[model samples]
Target chain A: MEFNFPPGLILVLGAIALPFLKGKIQQALIVLLPVMTLVLVWWIPNDYTLVLSFLDYQLSPVNSTPTGRLFASIFCIMTFAGGIYAMGQAKILELTAAYVYAGSAIGVTFCGDLISLFIFWEIMALGSTMVLWAAGSQSAYRASFRYLMIHLLGGVVLMAGIILHVHTTGSTDFTAMQPDNLASILILVGFLVNAGAPPLSAWIADAYPEASPSGMVFLSAFTTKTAVYALLVGFPGATILIYIGLYMVFYGIIYALLENDMRRILAYSIVNQVGFMVCAIGIGTELALNGAAAHAFAHIIYKALLLMSAGSVLMMTGKRKCTDLGGLFQSMPQTAINGIIGALAISSFPFTSGFVTKSLETAAAASQGMVAVWFLLIAASAGVFLHAGIKFPWFVFFQKDSGQRPPDPPGNMRFSMWGFSFLCIAIGLFPGPLYRLLPYPVEYQPYTASHLVTQFQLLLFAGFAFFVMLPLMKRTLTISLDFDWFYRRFLHIFAKEFTVKTSNTHIRIEHAIHQRIERFIKRLYRHHGPHGILARTWPSGGMVLWVAIMLAGILLTSALL
Target chain B: MISDQDKHWFYRSSSLPKLWMIQVFILVIALVPEFVLHHHPHFQENGVLVDATFGFTAWYGFLSCAAMVIAAKILGIFLKRKDSYYDE
Candidate 1:
């Protein structure tokens, strides 16, 4: 195959030089780079797969399957929107890291082998961690460390799985893999960890919120979505993910319901949205895969839209908790409006972007006769509406008048929010373009009389429940416990206790050993020192006596023999 | 009684009414696709069941929101803490 300079690489390479530029040049490059990448991705011809030989295996880095291209396109768009939103406020270091993080995500999208994917995956981890640290707060630094540990652990698991998989299959092509072998299952777990699957899901809420306002916007886009892309490519039909996804759906809702931090709530909702995509991937039909892909595309747009609004709020108020903020609609009108659009879209309200995308997955389950899965997904849909769709906007913008009135964000931030909000509606209103971009041919339709009516009832009833349950949903200063509690609190305490106990044991053993050594040394000195027989100036007399005894012993021995 | 400086700031601020209009506009925009463009092909074609599911989501979301508000009101009867209730 002919090698042409890949345009995506050039954009990222250009962005790396952005920090060196001053003021307007830096800002222009920050916005220009992602937009150029998006254009490159959009203009690239379809079905253009590329292969290269590496270490006796073929590496496919330019795989332009429809699914891969669609995800890549949106990731580029996210970078553009996020960069614009962050352009004014973010430090140069953060802006650079964000570009690198976005670039690596795009790189992963183009990778067609596990090795290539792994390389880009780890790049994304490190790059995003840098973004977190660039938040320029002590809490951000600590959180970035915790976040790094989690990703590093995930990277180790993924690398081990890749090694075993290459050994088992004698190939490293990243493709739809079955869980028939231990290696593939390990690979699945590794991807799931990054996907914010349970037990490890705590890392996302713990880390993302601590990031800078703009940093969180970029942070929200790449990592989990990359995992979804990986899952779509490999282990699509794994049935267990259905349940795991359902668990995450509820986990996000319940925790988000209890959360007070505005960004943290949105962070939790990211897991919830990704859970829908994971579930759809598990359903593993053409329609379901389309749903997963479409949802992911739509999710990144709306989720970023949400985070951008929240970022604006945080920027204005210097506060994150819901209780500390209210009546912000009085000050930041544009933000409030854009934020509500984001909320509506996320809730999958009829005719929104989420409405068009999320349904295909649930439909795929029903068509497959997976009754239990279908029911649970329906309930989870309600839960999504309850926690993220309503709770986020209501508390942050519309609840009691907290008497704090901050102005709207800067132009760049508003533009970012507006851009994403526009896409959310455009896609909802014109899903034909999105469906055409799917990996498979477009066939399924979202609207029907019965479909519309029932969806309305479910979401409306869920909204009703939210208001009725407002007492329970009050913003609390106390944090609800989650799986991270195991590592952050319990394990820390256990380690401290173990360290104390082991040190005490070590001291006691050292004392006993020292006493024994001292006693032995003292005995040796007593026997061998100057006052003792062997050390005396009369040692010649002792030597004679020893010789005489030796002669007596020798005579006796000779007689006995 | 409110201070004169506070009154002046409130009178001069563009926050309250502007925020209200923004929120109202957002709600209106959100409802547009639902009420006005509900029959668009994109919404009509993904799947009937999935469409139904979104419909359910709407009802479920509204009910939950309503419940939360009522519950907050009820909890205010006894459990409502001072703004600094949890502070040490």
Candidate 2:
């Protein structure tokens, strides 16, 4: 089917009039915008390609594939939920920016061609950066700038790839590709950058936690997940993604295991969870792809829930480190319970959202006889329980009492958390509806006795490992080194030292030149001094005598010569 | 010098053995899954017992956690820093 207005534009245009509206009405409009967009998303038919001819090329701006629709649905849902969560506390500008961000992400997801995708992609980056900067802290400001630079770099790489791709093939379709050309490889690199993939995966952990509590709800839902959607649509089955995904998985676990900040731990787990989806995408089987898609959906809910719980803690107590937070369950029982639900959901614990979803990825790997991949995935599964599943809630809400008695946050925050917590369990219990939304046929059972037994053993044992190793896993006031060191410190230091030395050398050279010029002037002044002979004014007689002598001497010298 | 008087029930030292008992009970429950489920070997009939072995995942999970912790400690020797590592 064809369309006149893009579904996501409702939010984009709706946000323009937000400033003119007052408090309660303004909040109503903000929440309504996404709800309207969500209705429009479902109302539109699948593969609703909106084609326009521009510059002799057919550009499809709105091409709603099943995967696109699925992601957009969640994005819209997230925007609605996050809007509700952010209202009353967050500045209207952040709310506006977040809606714009979610709109563009929806635009990118449903976008059919490279040009439109790039446009929406850039918007996502700008919008998210605004959300980060809206946190209004010095570190948050710095983190926002760093976050923007990395995403812009990813954007440029993606743009170059898109241009090359469209130029060579003479097509702008945003669909899957074989990594056979430099264009595709560059494109994959660009997509991987956003997917929180290796060598640069540190950006997610570094910048995401710095966002304001409400800002994080928006931040967590978009950006990386949109990239995950991009990988799903464009680069699925690329074998390299398998390794990149694996690296991100372990990288997140290891870093999170060593993390101290409450939100930062969740941030690290974002990379890790994205790693699971990327790995499933790498496996590239229909079931594996389904696994990736479902996991992303499940992940967004639980991850956002976890962040909300942590954000509530941050909002109420103004502290985020595990070293400073504990026994919040004493007063914040609801927050603790919700956070634990999020934690269990993240761990893919039995009868939670992750259980119904993440198992498909492992099942796909196992069925394929990818022995090593299967083993590593199982290990990562357990590792998830160890670091994120157990550590986040245990440290934040249930560890030794820090005597901080912050009450649960306001109604909006609690409502959203409860909503998400409900969805997490509901999806886990009744995955059939979610399963039906997948692009592929669904026949996988999440509650196979063997699978249940295996997951329970893995998770329970991981929990046991946590308590047993509690002493070693104690929180500290230290930040673990990651690849970000190269940018945040190493490159920063290198640039600082280089400028210092270069300026020093530059000053020395300039000083030396000045000294030489001074000496030359001094010597000339000495020779030509007024008191010296050549410089002296002579009397008439003396001048005539000297002239006669000089003339005679010159004449004799000439004759001799 | 922290007092235990105002601690929550979950935090009380008297509750420690009960918590451990509950954990062991959960471990026992975890063991019961293998007894009923006709477990499938992950790869093949002749394949090694990666997924099929009783509590294989448990041991792997525990060992992996231990290894990661140890590795992180070693890594901390070189990479860990005061939180003041980046202030500006």
- Which portions of model 2 show Cα errors greater than 4 Å? A508-561, B1-5
In CAPRI terms, model 1 is classed as: incorrect
lDDT by residue for model 1 (A196-217), tens: 9988998999999999999998
DockQ values per model: 0.19, 0.64
Per-model TM against the reference: 0.83, 0.92
A33-69 per-residue lDDT for model 2 (tens digits): 9999998888888867879998978888778789988
lDDT of 1 at A463: 66
True contacts kept of 2: 0.77
The DockQ score of candidate 1 comes to: 0.19
